[model samples]
Target: MRLLLIGPPGAGKGTQAVRLATHLSIRHISTGDLFREEIARGTELGRNADRHIRAGLLVPDEVTVGVIRERLARPDTEPGFLLDGFPRNPAQAAELDGILARTGSGLDAVLHLEVPDAEVISRIAGRRLCREDPGHIFHVDHDPPEVAGTCAFCGGELYQRDDDREATVRRRLEVYRGETAPVLDHYRGQGLVTTVSALGQVQEVLDRALTAIGRAGSTPRTP
Candidate 1:
């Protein structure tokens, strides 16, 4: 179940990645989480990435690819892994192919979660994250917390991330359009791209994703 999940900022790729990884019993490798971990530890890579991230710029491909290579070499990835957020452009996509080639492994499918730009803006603008755990996410309209401005899972304040701000999200969307969209074509050329709509309830989207992947000829592992 080696898969790459790609989508716009508010397409719910992160949530689906976690669920798909669990369903397939594969390692879930999220570049955003990886960057956060590195930055929290103040590693050299993190220090470098921090500058680009804070400036609302994409991290250099070399730095991003280095981190990914290290991660992909780990034992857990030997079986399979679900990759999210790393290959943001065609160059990184090609670099990923090179990295995997060294290990004689490659992606079975690249899932593109398609959502309209307007929907993306609406979703991201309403999204909030828990102070204690960013994983505890909620949307003001779609999935509000029991108490407004508070986390449902934990009694913590909920705040919108800077990246989720309307202006910032628009900028991010521009960057995605300029850089990341080509990666889809790169994978499509390999016949490894699967398109799925990102709008729907969580389970509904998951089912669509699963069906898409299954049609690609890969089945999730039994729990």
Candidate 2:
């Protein structure tokens, strides 16, 4: 399935993207990976993007769109692709429409993982990452480690990530809503949106997403 996955911060969108791409036998194309690939190759677009990113500013749409355009041209994308993290706003969404239209293809579904903003804040703010392995995570309430300030797996310091601070998370959520709402609206107009609750276990959420996608597929698209 050719799909666009949208979710706010702490919505578990990353995890679901991996699973959906695998299950559907499609290439998972994440914008972060696209940026890394460009930067690793020392492309001009990457250099520009690096400069802006280092300044804690959003990368210009031209550079990001250029990176995504190249990624979409790869051979693996011929089968299908699941796009994550691209098209953060309506303008990028329009750019994506143009890109795919040039190839005479369009997204079959736009999977929107829905979760309350308050819960999103709680989910992120409660997270603690291991000093040794940042991937080792524990939630203060849901999955706290044996010791309060230590990583159970690595016996390392467990500290809340700066981005996971409540204030930071709230700001991120605010930005997400402001940027992402219109993108959702754009797809909704095309009748491609498949909304699914992101609450509950991963498997349950995945099942809901699949069901939602299936239902969207059965509906006729607008011209």
Candidate 3:
């Protein structure tokens, strides 16, 4: 199924995207990963994005669109792909629409994982990471590693991200409310949005998401 997964930070969109992509046998295309790949390869688009990123400015929409276009053009995407972390605003959404139109394909569904702001704040604030691999996640209260200040896998130091600090979490939440929330309405109007509560165990939430999409009755199942 061609899908778009949207949610606030810490909402487990990344986790679900990985699982759903595997389940449905489709490529998982995350904008963040795309940018990282491009930058690592030092492509022209990557260089432009790096310039804006280093300046602490948002990468221009067209640059992002270019990366996405190239990704979607890949032959492996012919079956379908799951999109995460792109189309962050209405303009990007419109650009996506145009791109899909030109390619004669369109999204089948947009899954909006809804979680309360208070819960999101608490979850993010309690988050910790392994120093050796910052992406190795844990939660101080919810799911702490076996040893305090150390990674369970590699015994690396555990540290909290500055962005996961309470003060930074609030700012990120505010930005999501101001900028990302409106995209929900945009998809809603198109009758393509499936809202699923995202406040439960990760597997439970994924089940809920699958149920919601199944009920939508528009998504194709893998044969």
- Per lDDT, the best of the predicted structures is 2
User: How accurate locally is residue 58 in candidate 1, as Cα lDDT from 0 to 100?
Assistant: 77
lDDT of 1 by residue, 1-223 (tens): 6899999888999999999999999999998888887899998998998999999987889889988987898888888999999798899999999998877668888899999999999998999999999899999998999999999898899999887899999998998989998999998988888899999899999999999999876543221
**lDDT for predicted candidate 3 compared with the true structure:** 0.88
Candidate 2 lDDT over residue span 94-190, tens digit each: 9999999998888899999999988998899999999999999999999999999899998999998788899999899889889877899999988
Candidate 3 — which residues are off by over 4 angstroms? Answer: 130-137, 145-158, 219-223
What order do you get sorting by TM-score, best first?
Answer: 2, 3, 1
- Candidate 2 ranges with C-alpha deviation above 4 Å: 220-223
- The best candidate by TM-score is 2
| Candidate 1 Cα misplacement greater than 4 A, ranges | 39-47, 50-57, 128-140, 143-162, 218-223
The TM-scores, one per candidate, come to 0.81, 0.95, 0.89
Q: What is the C-alpha RMSD of each candidate to the true structure, in Å?
A: 4.6, 1.4, 3.1
Which tens-of-lDDT digit does each residue in 47-165 have in candidate 3?
Answer: 99999989999999999999999999999999989999988998899888888888777788899998888898899899888888888988998888888888898999988889889
Clashes of 2: 0
Report the candidate with higher TM-score, 1 versus 2: 2
